[model samples]
Target: MRKITAGVFISLDGVVEAPDQWHFPYFSDEMGAAVDATLGAADTVLFGRKTYDSFAGAWPEREAAGEEDAGFAKKLGDARKIVVSTRKLEFTWRNSEQLQGDFVEAVTALKNEPGGNIALSGSISVVRQLLAAGLLDELQLLVHPIAVRKGMRLFDEGDTAVPLRLLSSETFQTGVLNLIYAPAEPAADAGYEDAKAHLPQS
Candidate 1:
């Protein structure tokens, strides 16, 4: 079974939306290499409707222009793209498909199929759903130093706290932190009981 991994660029304040406005200052060869490695590891790309539309608008043009990262853009263009959307939209990108069914069920089926890992990028709502459904296997956050202060955050208010175990972390020269995490297993009953005992009685 392939693992479903989400790779996102976030600010110190947890803002994940519109990283392009602030992320470039922190870009470096190391960070670029890391992005390439992550993309290289995935045979499939997943996106929500908004993200799908955004990428479809931009990456194809970049690929055509032979811009820097054009090779990576080609890789993305060639990969199997599954967009979770109910609204009808023409998919002109090669190998792109629309997924209008139950998100968890559809993604679960994809995970069970034999293939390389799946990569998810720039879909906060979809990522939240995946986390809520316990469908995400790993999360990679490229944390930048600056705080955007006002934007859509990765974890919004009223969101449940999902336990995560740190798999690894690396710091780039540009002050970008690559933090990798996996969902932590549920605590044992005894361990939970022990922690509960320390809480104040009402």
Candidate 2:
């Protein structure tokens, strides 16, 4: 069973949206390398429709030729992606599929499938849903030092603190901190879900 890793590049105030604003500068190399590590370990990427659309438009251009391209964005175009969007959008990337129905059903089925870890990018809506469904296995946070006064946040209005144990923590030379967390395994519960649950038939 592959882990479901939630990867995020957030600010001091937990903003995960565009960081290229006049005041909020983009992430540095240290942050990039840490995020790249998580992307490298994943065989699949999962996102909501909004994130998929945002990424799809930019990743292809970056993959081919872009000055701001990173290692992860390049691999993103080629990795297996599952987009859970209900807005009736289309997918253009190869090995990409749209999950249109119930978010829980679609995400649960994806989790039960046989594959490597499912990495999540910037999809706060989807992340909240997944978090509520208790499907995320690991969390990789690349925390930058700057704080944006206003922007889209990663947490939902109803979201509360979920207990997590830090598996690893590292700080890079560029002042970015890498924090890897795993959900707290209950004393009696065998991990979170039954590992034997088979994937829903395609």
Candidate 3:
């Protein structure tokens, strides 16, 4: 099965939204390389309506303008773009399509199809849904050093806990951390007696 990897630029306090306001000062060559690696592995891109709108508004324009990021913009424009939304959308972007029907069923079917990794970026709602459905294979976070103190976070208050195991991590020179994780089986619950042996002796 093709792996589904979700990559997000997160703040130190777990904020994931509006990275443009707080993320660029910390961007470095290392971070660029890390992002390039993820995009390099995936031939398809997944987006929620919000992210799709944001990207569709910008990338094509950037590519057309021949900006510094024009190559990356071109890559995104060339990739198969799948937007997950309940409302009908007119996709003017090339190679773009809307994902219809049941969200989980449709995405599960997409996962089973033979293809390269399906990469998702900047789509917080979609990521949560994928995590809840157990459909996400990897969660790659580039944790920046600063905190905006107020924004939509990756996980909200009273959300159900989802256990994840760190697959790997790397520290960039700019104090950013690239953390890769995968869903993990819940740890067995244990009472005080289970840890008594490891307690400090007086």
Candidate 4:
């Protein structure tokens, strides 16, 4: 089965919203390479309606205008784009389509089919749903050093705790962390007895 991976630009405080407001200051060649690697590994891209709208509104025009990042825009344009949405959408971009049927069932079916990896970016809700459903294979976070202090967070209150194992980590030149994680089995709870050994002796 193909893997479903998610990448996000997040602040130290876990804010994942409006990265364009604070993300560029920390961009470096190292960070760019990390992002490129994620994009390079996927043949398909998944998006929530909002993210789809943002990219669809920009990338096609960027590719047509032959902007400096036109190559990247073209790459996105050429990929298979799947948008998760309830309302109907007119997809003007090539190879783009709205997800049909139930979200989990549809995505599971896509994973079971023969294909390269599926990549998701900037879709906080979609990522959360996938993680909750145990369908996300990996989560790649480009964690910036600053704390936005107020915005949408990657993990919210009342969310069921999902255990994750650190698969890999890299510190970029700008102090941003490239952290990769995979879903993990729930760890056994630690009680006072488990911590007693490290308690200070009077």
lDDT of 1 at 197: 88
lDDT digits (tens) for residues 1-202 of candidate 1: 8898898999999999888899998989998888777765689999999999899999898899997878888999989999988787678999899876788889999999989989898788988999889999988899999989989999878746678999999999888999989998765557676788899999
lDDT of each: 0.88, 0.75, 0.91, 0.93
Name the better of 2 and 3 by TM-score: 3
Q: For residues 1-202, could you state the per-residue lDDT of candidate 3 as single tens digits?
A: 9899999999989999899999999899898888878775688999999999999999899999997899998989989999998889998989999997999999999999998889999799999999999999999999999988999999876657899999999999989999999999988999899999899999
lDDT agreement of model 4 with the native: 0.93
Best lDDT goes to which candidate? Answer: 4
Winner of 1 and 4 under TM-score: 4
Model 4 vs. true fold: TM: 0.95
In angstroms, the error of model 3 at 76 is 0.5
lDDT of 1 at 114: 89
lDDT of model number 1: 0.88
- What CA root-mean-square deviation does each model show from the true structure? 4.3, 10.8, 1.6, 1.6
Give me candidate 3's TM-score against the actual structure. 0.94
Candidates 1 and 3 compared by TM-score, better number: 3
Comparing 3 and 4 on lDDT, the stronger one: 4
The residue-level lDDT of candidate 2 at 37 comes to: 71
TM-score of 1: 0.89
In model 2, which residue pairs have backbone atoms overlapping below 3 Å? none
Q: Which stretches of model 4 miss by more than 4 angstroms?
A: 198-202
